[model samples]
Target: MKTEAVRLYGKKDLRLEEFELPPIKEDEILAKVICDSICMSSYKAATQGTDHKRIPDDVAENPIIIGHEFAGELVEVGAKWAGEFKVGDKFSIQPALNYADGPVGILSAPGYSYQYIGGDATYVIIPKEVMELGCLLPYKGEGFYPASLSEPLSCVIGAMHANYHTTPGSYVHKMEIVDGGKMAILAGVGPMGLAAINYALNREDRKPSLLVVTDIDQGRLDRAASLYSVDFAKSKGIDLRYVNTGAMDNVAADLKAITDGYGYDDVFVFAPVVPIIEQADEILAFDGCLNFFAGPGDSNFKAPLNFYKVHYEFTHLVGTSGGNMDDMKEALEMMSKGLDPAGLVTHIGGLDAVIDTTLRLPEIPGGKKLIYNHIRMPLTPISEFEEKGKTNPLFTELHEICQLHNGLWNLEAENLILEKWNKLT
Candidate 1:
C-alpha cells in the first residue's frame, strides 16, 4: 500500500512525501488514518530529530512519521489478531508503546519511532506489539477527532490521578487530589491547561471545592471562561475562577488571597517558566501536592521550591509526561459519556499542511491544530472560518456548522470535512 505522510529526516527536517508501505505481517494490521491532532511533543521531536530519545539514531537513513494523537478505521486485520480486531472498526492508539524491543526501545512511540506508521499518514501498518500491549484501543465515539483528542485528555487524567496526599507520621500516601479541597492551575489557559481544567470539572469521582485557573493572557483566559463557563462549573459543584496573573501587582499574593490565605491543596503548573513553577509552589496549603505538568524543552530547566515547606509543611512534587493505558481508557469512557474536548481545538488543516505545522507549532497561536489526513487544505483557524468564508464555499459551510456549536468543531463539521475532502485521497 502507498501512504502519504510527514516524515522527519533530521533536526528541523520534515518532508511530506508519498511512499510505498510494506505488506502487513500476520501479526500486524493495516489501517486508514482519518484525523490527528497536532501536539507540541511532535514539534519537539521534529526540532530535536535524532536527539529525541524516542527517535532512532538512524532516522536519517529510515525516517519516521510525525504525530501521535490520531484516530482512524481498521482497513485490514492480520490473521493473528482477526478474532480480537476486525476490519472496519474505528480505533485510537495509545502511542506510548513502552515495549522493550520497539524501534527505539522502551521510549519508542508510534509518531516518533516507526517508519510506516504514524498519525500523519493516509495508511499505516500497526505493529503486533501495539495490540499485545493493549495500546490499540477501539473507539466508539461519534467522530475521529474526539478519539484522537483522547490521548491528550488521558494525560490530564493521569496527572490528576497521580496527585497524592498523606496522613501524618506514615509512609503510605493517599492517591488523587483532595476531594472538595482548593485547587489551582498556574498558567493554565493554554491547550493542555484547558484539558486539565475540563477534566477537573467533569470528573465524577472527586472534585475541588474551589478551582482557580491562572494565566498571563487575559484574552485567552476570557476565551477559556467562555468555553468552560463558570456557571456550568457551579452546576457541577465547583467554584471556578479565571485569573489574569499578568495584571496582578503580586502574582503569588493575589492568588493566595483567593483562598483566604489557606493556600491550595492541589497545584498544577502548566507553564515551564520558572516564575510559574515557583508560583505554584507558593500557593500550596499544608500537605499540598504540586504537580509540575509542563515538560520543558531545556534540560537545564530549574525552579525554586520551599524546602522549609517540604520538611515542615509536608509539601511535595511530582511530574508526569504521558498517560498509561488505563488513563487512555478512562478518557475514551468519558468521551462516550459526552464529555466534549472540542474546546481544545482551535485550528484545522490537512495532510499537505503537516510539515509546516509541525515545524512551526510553537510559533502558531491558539490551541490544537487538528489535521484530516486525506485532505489538502491549509492550516486555518476556526475563529477565522467566517472571515475566510467570503471567498470560499468550503469555509462558508464550515463557518455555518461551527456557529451552530458555539464556534467549536463538532460531529457535523467533521462529517462535512470528511465528505467534502476525502476525494483528495
Candidate 2:
C-alpha cells in the first residue's frame, strides 16, 4: 500500500513522498519500520555520488527512495518463514545488501554488487535469502534501546574483522588489531568518527597507550571529550588544534606535539578528506597503521598519501565501508552486555520533520540522528498505508488516493478503500 519515504530527486533535493508497495512474496517478511538513523553517508550521498553510485534507472527516475539505515519489528511473515517470527517481534535490519541481485537483494544472495535498500519507508520487505542468512535479528529485549544504532556499529565490526584489523589481531608476528597502545582517531567527534572511538575503547586487545581523537570542529571535539568513558584515560582536555594543510607545513609538527614528538602508532581517518591524509602519513610513527573509515564516492577521488612513509615506516593503509552481519552481531552483543548503545541515537524526530531533518543532517549537533517514522504519517494510501502503530489521520483527495488504492495499499487484510477502488478500476 502507501508508504512514506524520503526520496532523492537529482543532485540536491531530498523529500518525503508517498508511494505504493508490492505485496510480500512467499519468501518475504513485511517489516513495520519504527526507527531509522540517518547516517553521515546518507547526508553526504548526493555530494559524494557520481554517475556510478546514482540510483538505479527504474526506481524513481527523478525522486527514488533514499534511506538505507533503519531498525524495526517484523509484522508479517510468509507461510514458509512463519515459524521464524511472531507479532510484536522487535528487530534491527542490516540495510546494506551490496552483494546481491535484486533491488533489496531478494533474488540474489549477498555479495559486492547491489549494495543498498530503501529504508525510509513505512514498511520494508526483507527477502527470504536475507532472513535465511540470519539477517533478521530476533527480539530478546536485552537493553536494545536505540536499535537505530545497529547499522553503524555493524560497519565497525566489518572494519574490525576485515583483513586489516584481523591481521594485527592474530598475534603471530606481533600483528594485532585494535592497536590501543598508542592509537589516535583522526577527525574524531563526528558521528562516524565517534562510533570508531567507542568501538576502540571496548576492545580487549590493543588498548591505546594514548587515545588521541582530533577534529577541526570544536563542537564535535567537545562532544568527543564528553563521552567520559572512552577518554577517561589519556585524551587531553579536548581542545582542537586547527591545521591549515593549505600551508602544507607544520601539520606533522602539530601532531608531534600531541604524541611526544613521535608519531602515533595507529590512526583512523574517519572521512576521505585528502589533506588530512597528507598530514596523517607524516605524523604516524614508524610501523604505524592508517585506517580510512568513511566510504567515499567511486569517482577516483585522489589524495596525497605518502607511499614512501607507507614503505619506509613499515606502515599500512586500509579502508572500510558498510557493515556486514557479523558487525550487526557485534553491535547487538554490545547491547546485550548492557553498554549504553543509545549514545549513537542522538537526534530524534518524525516524518513531518523529514525535510527539515535531512536538511540539518550534515550540520546537526549530535551523534546518531534518528527519524521516528510513525509520526506525521499521511493517510493518502489508506488501504495499503495503514499500520498497526500508525497515528490516526484526516483524509483528503491525496490521502484518499493513498488509502483506497487496492492495487498497492490494502496489502494484508482488505479494507473498504481497497474494495471500492478495485471495483471501479
| lDDT (tens digit, per residue) of candidate 1 on 62-117 | 99999999999999999999999999999999999989999989999999999988
For 1-425, candidate 2 gives per-residue lDDT tens digits of: 56777766544566666767678888787777765666666656533332324344343353455565666778778887888787668887665544355543332222111222355667766666567667777645442234667677778656655524223334343444544446666676677766766776665544555676677666656545555344344353222232323343576687767777777766777767887776677777776767778666545877877788665556777777777776787777776665445445444455666656665565656566556566653212122233422443322332454334322211121122223322432
Superposed on all Cα atoms, model 2 deviates from the true structure by an RMSD in Å of 10.7
Q: How accurate locally, in lDDT, is each candidate?
A: 0.94, 0.58
Candidate 2 segments whose C-alpha is farther than 4 A from its true place: 9-15, 44-54, 61-64, 104-117, 142-145, 163-180, 229-231, 234-249, 363-365, 377-425
Q: Largest lDDT belongs to which candidate?
A: 1
TM-score for each model: 0.99, 0.74
Cα RMSD to native, each candidate? 1.1, 10.7
Our model 1 lands, by Cα RMSD against the true structure, at 1.1
The positional error of residue 385 in candidate 2, measured at the CA in angstroms, is 30
